[model samples]
Target: MCLLAMSNSLLQSAKKVILTEAQAVMMLADGLDQSFIDACQLIQNCTGKVVLIGMGKSGHIAGKIAATFASTGTPAFAVHPGEAGHGDLGMITQEDVVIAISYSGESDEIMTLIPIIKRLGILIIGMTKNVNSSIGRISNVHLDVSVEKEACPHNLAPTSSTTVALVMGDTLAISLLINKGFSVDDFARSHPSGTLGRRLLTLVSTIMKIGDDIPIVSADTKLLDALLIMSQKTLGMVLITNNNNILKGIFTDGDLRRVLETYPNIQSLTISKVMTPNCQSISKDRPAMAAVQMMDEFNLNSLPVVDDNNQVVGAINTHTLMQAKII
Candidate 1:
């Protein structure tokens, strides 16, 4: 073939691969039935974690499914089927649910261990192309991930089938996550080291400066004294509170610059005269992400964290959040 023909053929093959996978997903959605609901209920009510098992390409998809399940609130892990015969079956319990994936639904490695898993009285959720396959016939719930054709021209490779199985796994995990009322905080707790986890799980108190480090001054104080406090704290802002520790206003460097430009008698003014009244504040218990959002919307560099009684408890700045990798 000419080089031009080869390139055209390659592009057509890529397009076919994408379309086949996309169509498989759509067909899987159309075929979703009560079995999908049953599968979700089993996972939601399981007292223990989900155990996923499969072979070859199915095993790879099972691993991804296990990860999605674990991160979404359903504690789950993947175990290879061949390894199950070698004693990994002990990892499952009667209170847990077992999900097995196989394109043919009767991979010998998977079939050989089905009896042992069933003997444990563990509920089985089978994902396969044939609902009548050995694993499916015995499963408490069966998800048919059948595809009409593989993306491979020879129809030998696991292409559309694996893609559909993966989509089905995601469907199960996300549905279970929703049924369990799993919130962003719950997901973050499960993945505390990742970026999304850091943003959602990191608390304001974790990054906020407390005790003597908080830049605070009385409303009756002089502007020069407040600026000194701001300089000492280096947070670019001074919190103005009442003698009783009630936050009243805040005067930031922005406010100072504005005052300097808008007023001629800067040296004679009190802090309250130049302060921004009733400035926005956040709760110390709130997530750091919330603070970042507030700062972005208001173009602020810092905010005072208040308690239920509206008393300043701590102070957080953009720099601190950035340093903590929570922004």
Candidate 2:
């Protein structure tokens, strides 16, 4: 019982920490100033890559900022200040822009590399809480990421300060993305193995059922025959086509159930008499993510895939999209 009580108490404390950090973030809107605009302009005008450097928790945030920039159409990499003094400083080119992160702007490891970075003719953008500190005074552009207080109960850990710094870094990356005219497709390309990429890059033709797997019936076919085709093809619906193989209508399991409710003898009724005409259909070349959006917009479980000529070439179900991770 004592151990369980201790665990519960720790969880409650953690929740309070997170809530305090959130409150600190909500207060950041008032701190936006001209310095923020200067930082953004410096990064936007940079012709070379952005080199991020920091120590400890700042280093972790710098690494994430580098990744965000790279994924958002900016070339960037994180270099450790300690590593820079050893051999990693070679990664810095004269055309690059260095972004140094230091909460107090007094980290000796970071300060030691500033002269070398400056001597190489690279521009420096400093992120710090103290705008009057050495790093801020020496940098070409200084971004203030000061916070009211740390979320840490002891007021010693880097909590709210790191959050503010990360937010500032994200703001810079997003602003550059807009200035560069980056699109969702470009982001998807950068994250091809991620969920966003699967949603945006996967085409309808990649997931739709084709050839004999497609359940198709003539517009004049009997309802019973369509049901057999749907069962044989194992797709819950059957596409109705005319003599030219153009899609005319669709009969799904829901339609069958509704018709059976009214007719009670739907098996004897013709497909044309009960089929839903002018039903929604997707193009084969359309993005699977677009199809998912359409399905959600129309509240459908299955959709017919058609070509430019309005011919039913395939069919796709919600399960197929789920398997492709398009949801």
RMSD versus native structure for model 1: 2.7
Tens digits of per-residue lDDT, candidate 2, 45-118, equal: 88889999989999999999999999999999999999889999998899899999999999899999988888
Q: Where does candidate 2 stray beyond 4 Å?
A: 1-12
lDDT of 1 by residue, 201-320 (tens): 889988899989999999889998889999999888999999878899898878888998999887878999988888999999998999999999999988999999889999988889
Clashing pairs in 1: none
lDDT, candidate 2, at 324: 80
TM-score of decoy 2: 0.94
Model 1: runs farther than 4 Å from truth? 1-16, 194-197
Residue 171 lDDT, candidate 1, scale 0-100: 97
lDDT at position 245, candidate 1? 85
Computed on alpha carbons, the lDDT of every model, listed in order, comes to: 0.90, 0.89
For model 2, give the 10-residue run with minimal summed lDDT.
23-32
